[model samples]
Target chain A: MTATLTRQAPQHAPDAAATLAASTPSWSRRAKNRAASAAVVAAVALTAVPLALVIWAAVERGSARLDLTLFTHSMRGVVGQGGGLLHALTGTLIITGATAIISIPLGLAAAIYLTEYAGGNKLAAITRRAVDIMVSIPSIVAGLAAYALFSLILGPGTRSGLAGAVALAMIMIPVVVRSSEEVLRLVPADLREAGLALGSPRWRVIRKIVLPTALPGLTAGAVLGVARVIGETAPLLLVAGFTDAMNYNLADGRMATLPVFIYTQWSSKGLDTAAYDQRAWAGALVLMAVVVVLQLAARALPPQIAKLRRNR
Target chain B: MMAAASAVALVLVGVLVFLAVNGGPAVTAGEGELPAHAKNFLALAGPLAFGSLWVAVIALALASLPAVGVALAATIYAPSPRFGRFLGAVLDLLAAVPSVVFGLWGLMVLAPAVVPGYEWAHAHLGWLPFFSGEPSVTGRTVLTAGMVVAVMILPIMAAICRESFALTPPALIEAAYALGATRWEMVRAAVLPVARSGIVAGGMLGLGRALGETMAVAMVLSATPSLISFNVISAENPSTIAAFIASTFPESTGAEVSALIGLGLVLFAISLVVSLVGRRIAKQGGLR
Candidate 1:
């Protein structure tokens, strides 16, 4: 009778508790999956907030002060309002241009040597490590190094746009080398072998075939380096002493850049100073625009150049 | 070609030598007023070094949580491939945003916005030493600077972790699913285990950045050049090495300059060691 009752109970409750047990695990799993998804969504949104806030604040505050004079006139003696970022803009262009001129060739050459000649040797490893270390050096330290180097050579308190450029170049070189090296490594080994088999010297092959193939990527890397250093404030703060007047010469005299201009405007102002604050916002906006445009160009150039080559 | 490569090595050596030579005086004999007599020479390096470590630690801890989540979202939880790609681009853009711009925003916008929250923390969580201070209205506390650093490093950490997560073996994930595992379970059993080392390396890399970040910290922190203090929310400025160099270098003369350089050298060494270790770990984790 006990055995018969047990068998009967199993048959009666098979679709009730048994089925519930089978579905409970899946229910909990589904709930866990939903919670994880929600957590990811929350994370993405939270991470995006700062970027959105910065862009929004820049646009809102910057647009109020945007005008022709703000771009055309120099802030020579303007105390609280009026004038523009003309000197700062010109100085930024000159300093950044000088930095690019200094960094690109040296960086490209280092990259070529690392990729073509070094070939896992101890020197190559050391060079690679040095580049890595350089990549992480603080911009302010780079500024100090440039300051010390220039000050010692040209007497103390010597501030020049050239010194600032040197400091920026110090920061940019490692970036250029690393990025260019990565691109160079991506060039197919088979292509190198074929070029060698065709009786071209190694240098000629690298110069003609590898470099041309890597030109777009190399440009991208150089542009990335420029983008990285163009907005640096601390190095410029130490090396390029602030100048309100327009200074075309990079070798002598203090000059101003957008970053430094913004910093001075913001920091030098006393409490409740609206005009300087407004100018700072406008300068920040312009700087952000420049950086964003360069970044877009960097991203777009490689693909466009590749397409052009394919068409040719 | 080899000469060019060696030039980079030479530059590295030159920088180190320059710092050592210039900063040597200050490091050996500290006798200068840091903030026009608020502190003496001996007080400079210790406080700044401690401040750097303190802020960087807090920033790293704060950033890692959201960074890991974002990486997971982009890699494993995105609604579609295109969405993931879009999210990746956004993160890249965030990474590309200038540090100074971040500083400006932190000082102008974020500082004011967080005043209430800081006050609330000070009021309610005062029992915790980290929150035990009278909150300032300006919001330029060490905690605020740390949050700014956290924001700055988030994209970097996220990008690295996302790349690692994307490289997780699909076969393992599929096997987990085949064993009747849920999506979260599949990630737990396969993805997390595979990407753990990469995530840690990425966090360390971010920490390296946080350690050396200058303008943002300089702008946001009130920067009291004092000895180490646990009071994070107070108006007492916590001076960091990079920030100290930047703010003081302009007006500093003589041994003061040397001392700032000394502080810079210390910062450089710390960041170098951190980045080297991070790079090694990242390389070992199979990231190029």
Candidate 2:
């Protein structure tokens, strides 16, 4: 009778208890997971709130105060009409253009050599390691390095737009080289082999085949590099001294870039803090807009480049 | 070929030469305005760099939790495909936003918004060292700086973790499911263990960026504080090496400027070592 009772109990009570225990762990786990999820959602919300507030502030303050004089006239000590940032804008474009010119060819060549020609040799590996080191060097160090070199050549107290561009170019090279190499390596060996099989030389195969296929990725890297250098403030401040009126010549006296201008406006505490603050915000917005444009351009590249590649 | 290599070599030489000539003499001497009655280099010890790095570490660690969470949720739960895509794009755009803009936002928006909360914390939690202080002049404090740094680093960390989750071999996930393992069980047992390394790597990179960033820190922090005071709401300005460089380079005189440059060098060396180590760990599949 005892055995019979035990068997009956095993079938009913044991099954229920086992089920409850098995399900218990999951229920508790579910509760923990929900809490974790809520915490993350809260954190992300926290991050986003401040960012949204900033954009709102910029729009509110900017619209209320921005005018043509901010863009057209130089800061002429007028009550409200400190002319345009025309000079600053010009200085920024010219200096950045110079940086691109200096960095792109050198970086692209370095990338091509590393990815296509070196075949992962010891030398290539060392070069890659050096590039990695260079990437982490602070922007200010690059500026100081540039300042060191340019000051020796031009004598003490020599700060020029060219000096800043050169400093920026140093920073730009490692980024471009690393990104371009990665993108170029992503082009399958088959494409290159196919080109070589046609009796094309290695250089020709690279130019005619690999480069075209990887153009979109390479362009994206370049866009990122451009964005990185354009926003750099410390290096520019160290190398390019500020000027009220923008000088277009990179090799000559003070040229004002947007970053430096913003720094000066914020730090100098000149009369009319509002105007200076507005200019700074406007400058930042313009810089961000440029980055957005570059990203859009980068995103647009694959389709256009793919079509071109196919035609070739 | 030799000429090309030499040209590259020349650029490197120029860089070294320039820094030496302009920055050498200054490093050997005391730079910046020294505190009165402070005699030696050791006396120059202020809480500035310590404060900056402390804030950075705290912020990144705090920020990483949410970042990893979102990545996990988006990956494991299979959030609606559209929502996933939207969040991914938004995060990427956030990553692309410049640091200076983040600083500007902190100054104009976050500072004012947090003032009331800061006051409340000071009123209630005044005994706690972290919350004890007169509210800052502009509400720009260690907390605001940390938040900005956290925001700047979040997208990269999230992306790294998300990729790690994606790469969790489907076969393992399937096997866990077959054993009647729930979604959470499978993730805990199979997914996270496989992806731990990637997450750490992502976190390290974020930390490195936080440490080296100049503009945002300069714009957001009160640059006047010279000590390692932990009070986030202190009226005193806290300074970091990067901010110190940006704000003082133009106006510094004699040894003061050189010392700042030395600090810049130190900052550079720190970032370099971090990146190299981070890269190795990343290669080993340790960090996301």
Candidate 3:
């Protein structure tokens, strides 16, 4: 090692001398570094290309013959004329909202049990593992499972928006549980200790202290879950029967969702093909926009809340 | 608390049980009703499943390469905080985009652009079995699907890797630099090993998504042929299990629906097992 170091030190001096000599002309190093940096930037830009393409396509397909009726009117047979995505929009909202309602409380309760009450008990660990596994189960399988159960229970020929909600609920639960657990865990032991020291009960500490601290993350998780479930078509395809007209009832009959509408239009025949395609694009664009807006809101909330907390 | 946890566990188990009892009977009935069709379908399914997995592995590899590179660049070589933030926001948007949107774009734009390249491959590599399918309208081959899968999974792998890199204490990096390690060497020896498990976890997470993805696969693949081929340009549809169930289930009547449900059950069973294993491996960090 010494011998190698001795040899390297002499070489380093010569290299330093050359660098010093070349340092007078800054253009060469700067150019090289710039080129290298540009390459990295180019690579990152390539990643954005697909996204650019999607945005471009959405705009092109959605706005070429865009109109208000596409959002205002239902998917009635209006010949070649465009109709608004009321059916799909309504279905997506109803199903996703229902899923959120069902999953949030269940996941929150489970997280509370795991983090606050269960500690490291064998059951808690097992539940944690189960939650982890559940998160990985593909949304499609959840849909299928929902189909198997719902169909079996309801009858041979049964499809409803409620089934879609159930399928989405399955997908949402794991994500909410995992995200909520992480957030709850992030609540410092000190905070919990302080709460305990104040003689507050465990449930009170969790409900008041930990949940508020974790609220931002929990909200973010829920928004993400909504985003995920909103685009889901496979499960909806299996469980939620496709409908052309607006259907408010989730418990019975068919309902249309943006995703399933897209799939149906693309797969089915020329029933105002271009118009249907436009609606599909519009639906997708709106869905993506909603998700982006929600995510931004979720991201912005923490800083805004933190600032508010500081001001108080 | 235990009871609630048990409830969560039971929900998952219930899903499996439902599939088993329902799908199992359907599969058995299928063997009797349409044995030949079932055999053909299974033959098709086996290869397609493996092909899909292969596509996923390749896609993951491609996705991880640039993702890791960009992540490293953002962390180490970024010129300024503004640049870093911009890069981060871009990635966030990329991650946030819905999968259906990706599928739609893939079908409309990427597929068309890809078709010509695929034609070239077909013209050149006509001798290959896999590449022997009819020319698709676009480059909607397994390769493209794989590439799309890579893109879809990039954010996840990159995020995990980036976090792991960030977690490596700056002190360790300085120590390596002081010891005369190059930037690349420092990353390899210090950052890479430390983050290896996290990276795998991220990759597995992405793999899970790829295996189970519905819209993307449904939109992208032609999915007509039961025969598997090595040809990348073949227009033959490479169907995934998810695609099969989605397309068939709605139209299925009586036992036919049950049969489709059975196929879905198989898919669920496979995915559930894979996901469970993925979680275990990720938690153990042994794969690193």
Candidate 4:
């Protein structure tokens, strides 16, 4: 069917070609085309300039303090320059892991129900709108929500990795649901039909056929969610609070994420304080690296996993 | 499955209810130890809300032109489709660059880079209220913060606009060409009409981000805690609701905390309405 459509596609093309050939291009047309091309070039250049400057500036300044200590040592006792981001890095990983644990299943389940079961019901429509609204909730607002909820339950001055994870989870869930729904919608209907035709129940078909096919996309979506919340500073500032020393506990004590660490370093530093600024730049670089790596993995991993599955 | 789906709805309602209940006092009784000269919570809120609006509007205006250009360059005016794809990827990467990093850049690089231009604006454009005041010594004015927010939203706006432009029917474009239209004319006549809804939706989404943006604005603007001024170059600039919440939440207690939360609720409501409207428009335009 696609072959016939492709073969017939060119049948109407000659009329356009004839029209193009008959109309001789005018000077004004050429000038407008030139102007348009210039506009596009200028736009591309303008957009590229800021990005280039950011990456360049990050690498140039961030690398000055990007030593081995940055990955290994914690900024516990060091006053000026010699400490590292080990504490913040570990806290970020733990908090992000907790967020993943909490959000992934909920997001996937929501996506599945929306795509497979809801079927244009009012409930699904409301859930979809809720998700859309959730997507736009500011990171700081999420922080406030988490803070209010946790402070009410745990009492005021409550700051922990768990609270931060919950805040991140709030932001991540909508992203995961939206992206997973898109991926699930892309799965062809015939596959579901085939499974159902074999006398499989709806749940079995979705579980056995649909979920696995969409697994790679789901993973990508989850990773995208992680990439988003991992850099969030405001929410973590409100929920996690800031800690100079390392604290591995999620529920008990304050934790330092890379973003908040950077924030404190810059904001709390005294005038003409170079070392603290250096540390902040290094932390920013590391945070950027983590996000870029996740994005790259998101793009690369799905195809490789598909290839491996095919081979197996 | 049903439980999980309902959780999203529950959280949405929960957040709003929590904010309303906790922040209710500030709205009704003005219970907080108000910022140094403020008479009430409403007085404090008035400036912050307007500041958020003013900066976001400025950011949207500054971002939209470059965003549209980049989107058009990537879709309609690219020398090659592959190059366009590359440009799209670059923009995506830019979007992934965290707000904190942008904040750091705004503080360290852009603030200084814009000093000379800011000085020129203050010196020459002083007749206008928006550019009237002396540029701040540190260059941490609302204008600088607005520019930083503009950079942050550019990628989002461009990506959305590019998707809509790319979806313009090939036949329509060809028809324009056949009618002896120039490339710019083709885009203006064929692409813009089809992409108009998406463009507006994208602009609103960018506006939402600009409004809610906290870390970058907090870092860039030397926030004036309780004052509102229209002077873009002034050191005495108003704080945005999100920035105010972030900066004050750590130190707030009781009524002050409630006031901060009240400000947050306002930010939440504004962003929610803007995003919902944007999403609806995008949906109507067949964009997911």
Top candidate on lDDT is 4
Lowest summed-lDDT stretch of 10 residues in model 4 chain A? A303-312
In candidate 2, what fraction of native interface contacts survive? Answer: 0.36
lDDT of model 3, residue B101? 74
Compared with the true structure, what per-residue lDDT tens digits does model 3 show for residues A1-312? 875774464445657877656544356645664665666567687687877878888888877645777678886775565666788889888888888888988888898898899868888888877786777778888887888788679876778988888888888888888877877776678888999999999889988888887787778777877766777878888889788899988897888988887777666747567766776687777877777787777677556445634554
Write model 2 residue lDDT over A62-145, tens digit each, in one string.
Answer: 554367666676554444325556677788899999999998888888888877777767656666666766777777778878
Q: Candidate 1, after superposition: displacement of residue B52 in Å?
A: 0.9
All-Cα superposition RMSD per candidate:
6.5, 6.5, 5.1, 3.3
Model 1, range A103-145, lDDT digits (tens) per residue? Answer: 9999999999999998899889989989988999989999989
Tell me candidate 1's TM-score on chain B. Answer: 0.95
Lowest-sum lDDT 10-residue window in model 4 chain B = B29-38
Cα displacement (Å) at residue B211, model 4: 0.5
Q: Model 4, range A1-312, lDDT digits (tens) per residue? A: 986775564455658777756686788888888887887788788788988998888899889999999999988877876889999999999999999999999999999999999999888998998998898999999888888888789887789999999999989999999999988986778889999999999999999989888788888889989998899999999989998889999998899999999999898885548988989999999999999999887876567445734554
Question: How do the predictions measure up, each by TM-score?
Answer: 0.93, 0.88, 0.88, 0.94
Q: What is the TM-score of chain A in candidate 1?
A: 0.88
Root-mean-square deviation of candidate 2:
6.5
Which ranking of candidates, highest DockQ first? 4, 1, 3, 2
Q: Model 3, clash count?
A: 16
The alpha-carbon interface RMSD of model 4 comes to 1.2
Q: Better model by TM-score, 2 or 4?
A: 4
In order, candidate lDDTs are 0.87, 0.73, 0.73, 0.88
Model 1 stretches with alpha carbons more than 4 Å out? A1-24, A270-272, A304-312, B33-42
Lowest lDDT 10-mer window, candidate 3 chain A? A303-312
